[model samples]
Target: MGPPERTILGSKASVRRPKERLEREERPRRKITVLPTGRQFAVVRMDPLAMVSHLDLDSVAIEEASAIKPKKYLVYLDAPQDLPLPQSQWCRFWVQPVATTLRPAVPEEGITSDMVLPIHPNTQYAKGRRLMNCTPQFPFPHCYLWIRSMMSLRVRTKRGVDVYDNDKAMTVSIDSHVAFMSAWNEDSRRMFALRRAALSSLSGQTPSSEGKLRKSPSPEVVQPNAEHSPSFATLSIPPPLRIYRDGSASSDDEDTSQASDDAESPHAPTLPPIPPLMALAIDTDVFGWAADPKVPFVPLVDLWFELEDHLSPDNIPSPVELWREQETIGA
Candidate 1:
């Protein structure tokens, strides 16, 4: 009986059992179908001030708006635009002038009558749930409402305001950009400087309760530790004073055949001092995406008031197929 159990027939069954189990388990998991994959919401108007971060809403005021409420409706987005959440997750959502009151008024002494401020002063966010359905539903139930924009918005300025008629504004479809905020937040001087400033602020003095951004201390040269000698900061472009006839370079600068920085020798081209910040500022080019005007503008901010929801898989776009007269479709 034991010999029979060890036979090729038994061995085959033993091998097949686990392999079949694994195949079953490894079957591609089904993605739950999230209905209303996207939504088209109307952003009655764009609030210029929403563009600015770290702004205190309490102080800003809309002294007077051009129109209390513009009746026109022009702009609309695809309903339930692909969002970061799964099939059923809601997204961060809100709109300007949620309140009946306009934004705060500008103090007249410093503010002229017609200065265009990047702020929707005195305007408030639409009541908590008025704009997008931020209220999270189990698997994103609020999605039934699927985030809608209130009509009749008042876009305001310091002295006056212009109403963006929903009907006049452009309609746009948003697919996730392959290079998501690459130049700005991920790798940019302004953002890096800001992060450094924030870190320095936290590490150094306590900030005032008034919510003012504390003036950051001037940048300083950080000395390297004793163990990590020959740091990048300490390394300099050895002036190309002396040219080599031809030879292998040495690991140590002292052993190299290059000439010392001596006035008697022909000097390397005098390069202006390149501090790290200056080097970074010059290296950063936010305009890289500006080569084409048709490319939709993706706001650097995290908010989703007007921008399309791009995080969800459903929102991901299919590759465009190009052809002259006819092209073969993949089998």
Candidate 2:
């Protein structure tokens, strides 16, 4: 026993340990695919007046929409088709009339007898849980219902002094485009942006053309410090010393020049007995200071040196016979 009986480190010890560990850890990394279901519950029938209100009266063409025929139209509520919670737990209806092109009705003028003003739903709510849920119909939970179809619905005459208010006359006119609106909340907007980015990345499109896009800066490459530079990131082990000795019963008076020539000549007609050569290389990795306080990066310097050395011409292991040896050792 030498000193404290320390065990001698063999060649493949480091190689087998990491190979087994890395293979086990790298097993499960698969891709996931998800599809979106485009469904919505409510519809908002915007009024022409809403659009007119948003426009600047000084520059707008208010009289341009006078000849346009007004009819009942439908604008389905199109949410971004995705929600933060997977399922929508709460529902709300936001109403904003188109004001850019639709002008508000004057107080003195009355709704026209020939004009068609589709009444807003009296009561509206969602119906189904995950898919299609039905909201309430009639006696609207929120607004006062006003349905007016001058030709079909009978008009009631009021006995008040003001006959103009009682008379069914449509005076205020706004552009028809003001009757449509886009629906989305803050969370929905964010998810829509993410979806748009993913689609754009797949199709190779610019941000401006896509409905929504993301802009992220590229990572910067850093230069290494001269003081900290080692060929590898970590500290390496020194190679083992190999000693070769040749002993032969030969004449002591033999010419030294002839022996040297026989060993060095590549086309020599005669050959001498080969000498035994031993080669050993060992490697180890040391930990380095982490850029972040919580995370650490390991530096692998000569970690693979021993493995590469063992497979060299001087130390090549028998592959076919090594498996049998390993089986016996494991058994």
Candidate 3:
């Protein structure tokens, strides 16, 4: 159960319900599809900071962009659109969303490429010489769609690893208080997710633990109420995933921490809260080592995503103001 609903993008919950939307046009060879399942969303790739800095939230329709705690969806944008070339030989696209949420699974004790993402034997570099960057371990062709929520178990990378010509939908289900995202192309250390949490408690408090604070594990996860608007929709987090070493994969239900060690997670450094009105800046490593160890890799790929915490004090009324009954009626 949750509190009463609040209007988002200036609209009510009824407006966010799913509708029979028309299928968008697609180009040959390349594809982009938004399932008519959850709330409406706009997916485009650009330096979010460049656009958000000039964005006027007041001018935007107050009728809620999505539900208060919106159901997530896949924002497929793998179109062959022209992207600005990187300064060097390599380029990276670290996918992040301003309005979305996730609960990143922490990297377990022992993790490998096959465990992180599936490795197909037939489609791998051994068989497909034409496939660039294809390694004995890393077989994925390009960055695809993925969604990691507070309750997700494993990734879909392995869903069709064995199926031949398996064009099986590597789709994502955007559940309530969930997140939709692009494939995680970075190493295990850098892998993290967005967290859908109550920002009201975090609004006043600064980070007490090394400029960061995490939610304590609870059996009953708090579900966001569409009726209530939070200061921010979600949080970026270092969550843990199932583990497998010499044995098969299994969940260590006893552990509740995000990542185990510091050195193990250099990519996901301890982050500070983004200042008021500033976008959350994140860098994702998209490096692919070459065959020869002697060859020096000059240009390292990195994708940057600047996230704007749309939920702020200015938009939502303070609790003190909402409950204060006009100058206090003399105690």
RMSD of each: 27.6, 40.7, 28.7
> How good is model 3 by TM-score?
0.18
The residue-by-residue lDDT of candidate 1 on 1-331, one tens digit each, is 1232222674365334555577899997532222212223332323223422222223322211211222212122333212332322222222211211111111211111111111112212222222232212111111111011111111221111322223322222332111111212222343344444555566563423314544444321222223312132211111111121212334346544344545236666655789998667556633232222211111111112222322231221111100100011100
**Tens digits of per-residue lDDT for model 2 on 226-307?**
3322121211111111121123224433667677778789976665644433111112111121122111101000101122
For 99-119, candidate 3 gives per-residue lDDT tens digits of: 121122222211121212211
Provide the global lDDT of candidate 2 against the true structure: 0.24
Worst ten in a row by lDDT for model 1: 322-331
Full-model lDDT for every candidate: 0.25, 0.24, 0.24
lDDT of 2 at 129: 11
lDDT of 1 at 265: 62
After TM-score superposition, what is the CA distance of residue 294 in candidate 1 from its true location, in Å?
37
Task: Go through the candidates in order and give the clash count of each.
Answer: 38, 26, 22
Q: What is the lDDT of residue 94 in candidate 3?
A: 29
Q: Candidate 2 has what TM-score?
A: 0.16
Cα error of candidate 1 at position 114, Å? 23
On TM-score, the candidate that comes out on top is 3
